[model samples]
Target: MNFNREDMNIVIVGHVDHGKSTIIGRLLADTNSLPEGKLEQVKERCRRNSKPFEYAFLLDALKDEQEQGITIDAARCFFKTEKRDYIIIDAPGHIEFLKNMVTGASRAEVALLVIDAEEGIKENSKRHGYLLSMLGIKNVVVLINKMDLVNYDEKVFENITKEYTEFLNKIDVEPKCFIPVSGFFGENIVDPSNKMSWYKGQSVLEVLDSFEKEKLPDDKPFRMPVQAVYKFTRDGDNRRIVAGTIETGRVKVGDEVIFYPSGKKSTVKSIEVFNGEARESIGSGYAAGFTLNEQIYIKRGEMAAISGDIKPKVTNRIKVNLFWLGRSPMVKEKEYILKVGTSKVEVKIEEITKVIDASNLNNEVKQQIDRHEVAECILKTDKPIAFDLSHEIAQTSRFVIVDKYEIAGGGIILKELEDEENKAHKENYKWEKSYITLEERAEKFGQKPALICITGKENTRKKAIARALERKLFSDGRRVYFLGINNTLYAEDHNKKEHIKRLSEVSNIMMDSGSILIATASELNRDDIETMEAAVNSKEVIKVWVGENEISEIDEDLFVSKEDTVELAVDKIKSLLQKKNIIFKPF
Candidate 1:
């Protein structure tokens, strides 16, 4: 088979001590890709440690790795078969290093799952396979290594291969090729082995060389997520270039494109690459900058796609399938930072709809998602961010969740909720009244004053203040709706953005009802505080500061002591309510 110089990235993955590194080392050595004198240095180091020379040492060249005899980090090694060049990523097999494994596997186009013939399919081996599938890696080649330890027995290889194939079937990963080889003995790797005459399959190198590289799709709609904007002054020429890798499809010199989330439109003036102008059109897998005919506003992470093909939607609510890797349990009502593509937005878990059992891919009904558990949960962001479904667009659909500067989870967007009525309903308030509607009561009571309570931490104090103020206002016969800071049931779970959006919705409800809106929340940031202030009825919102320090932004001396109980505070607030000329009868 003829091979072209296409870029093929392969990841070596399996359980620990499954001869993955050994196979890679042998592949590099047999292909003459190792640097001169590097092999001799490894050999000397092995001898100094009183250890026999191992092929795996060639790849695990790190000193720490040599001491521990375990690969702690993913290592990338470059080599070439006679047909094509390859960048081989050796992923760690330990379960503790699963994050590192994901880091490596994310860059690979194909995976090489190594299995020991004697041990058959193991825990990490199956796990790596399952993760690869989740990452959308469809190309896999299974290698049954350590055949020499089994006396190169064909029956042993066949039995293990059959068992592994069954396990892979359960996970829905059909390997393109399964080869039996001994990396230590240098058999069935670079060349065919005569010892295993029962096996007539191609060698490892031959199979890899023969595998067809999937071509980038060119017929789909053009999508270029703007990564950067460049203004270059060279040789007295001023040029503005919008640069990013083409995520999918193709674009030409005169195609009309739109910058999303902003809805700005422009026509492409020219496509520029580093090596000068190209004669043909550029498609996916190429990073090129384009100059637009009209100077329009475009920023990083903004998607530019062919106009009228597929419009990007800005949504606040999204459903995602998450894989948690955090130390603490993913609790409801907490907020976390979500980084998707180039946007970092505040997000909250709305609900733990269901937890997924990774072992069998079954949904487990639970309230919390613990570490190492996969779940289908709903996430709501503070603002609308452009995204596509995982099946529709994998590049823009994936995201990572960070809490306290560490990546706690990663997930893919499953579905984007787009019903405007449902969106409004999710953010609306439903209240039961006694005598009159809130608007009529406020109009009748001669403008009942409103109270806005703000705090800086999530604690019982926030809720306690709200309840106390509500009771006092009720006693004074004022129309009031005490909006608590509980957002756990809003969006399938308590997502931070959803919670904040819920707060915004409550503010709107207060404005529409024309009632005294009293909101209590902990750690309300400057922006959220401003949003709440803007949404309340200006004629009635009585701003109440209920914490230690005074919020200097809002010009009001409504500071209430944090130590006061709700009843005592209500008495003090009642006098203030009377002085403001606000009166209503208790219902």
Candidate 2:
């Protein structure tokens, strides 16, 4: 039994007061991993307080935790068997601390789901089971703790095991085995229990050694998000190197790579290191840098991937399965920052498809995702981002939402949604440089040029609102124009794409002249918006939906109800324009 093998991470999770900490404490004390006199110190403290000593006090070192008698944080402990070393992560069972539990369990390969035999299956028991599967922990073992209270009855253990297995099966989680254990008395943990002769199975220590270590993803598609681009000219050792830690697969010198979201192509020139020997190749889990053959201008947040491998999806919209743990409910019409890999971008909840109750597995159709609720939603980013689907590469598919500078939620990307702007036929045409920069034009006009698309259903008051907005802006001493989509000049043919292209060309001219171009196109889909954005280089396109029911799948910036009068709609659009800085606010 070689104990020098790779270490395995295992998380212990269950409901509050279900003996999670007790199990960890017993495992540590039994393995002789505790420091000298540490156990005596805790026992003396318990005696001073006139309380009996328990095994749970060994890991709950926090004063608050000792007084409250519940784990507030994810505590960690280490122990070793003859086969391999184990890092046991003790996650909290309180519902308020589910976010901390998720953070800890995400780093583990196996999960230990404990259930109170005397309390039967509780709410957190089911919730923890589902989360274990969602976190990609495939190997799970059921620990029926506190069997002493149940008189070590085999029937009590079997009934709880049957109920939990059914729940796990619904979530596609199959437990490896169910072991009845008394962590308080250390039965079925390290030594066999003489009380239960009918049960003949491996101990908890034996099961830990049976689980295999998860293999590193060195054979998958290569993925490395560019962290920084360094150029050190101080010592005359000028090497334009792109540096990042590889998330998966391996890379070698001379390999053709493509930077995502920009589609820039380059070949790896040379592997780089500081104060070390030269290398020709590098694998995952190592921070490395390499120069490129072409001088491509790629900034941070761009994913550097091998060309021949499965290319990452680039889009502004995605469908994800996420859990909300924010102080406020995740609602529509508000923006949040989504961080995935090294890329952070402004994201908004476009639509909430379903909100799931993790404990009962019940789903409801709602517009907002409340705290502690799991939801499947469509999120649209302000710009395009590069990512892989969770099924393809789980490492790069995970992301977190930052609200008010705090990580309020986390999730995995389920599917990539095609954005019309990103799906447009990409060409290698170079833009003709203008003599004056955009800053010069913006300063001269006292406002930034923009393309305002007033879109909604056919019967909605889109054209009326568009004309009213243009009239108000013009009266306010600003250059503005109202163009109808069905203008006879470009509406001659029925080709919608060609018609949109021509309209976009006209709008581009108006925007270039520093005028706010308001175009009314009814039932405009995402593809139409993409075409218009591609034509107007670098200008912001604000889609204002002028109806209650948004039939088209356009990611609109503002929504004005059709019940509002033309004056109110115009005011709403004006306020939005001011907020977006399309027009200067009055001092």
Provide TM-scores for the models: 0.67, 0.68
Query: After TM-score superposition, what is the CA distance of residue 39 in candidate 1 from its true location, in Å?
Result: 2.1
lDDT of 1: 0.71
Most accurate candidate by TM-score: 2
Q: On a 0 to 1 TM-score scale, where does candidate 1 land against the true structure?
A: 0.67
> Model 1 RMSD to the real structure?
11.6
Model 1 lDDT-worst window of ten: 96-105
Model 1: lDDT of residue 316: 68
Off by over 4 Å in 1: 1-4, 62-77, 93-106, 233-238, 278-280, 360-362, 419-422, 425-587
Instruction: Please provide, for model 2 over 83-126, each residue's C-alpha lDDT reduced to its tens digit, 9 standing for 90 to 100.
Output: 77777654464332334433222467778888999999987788
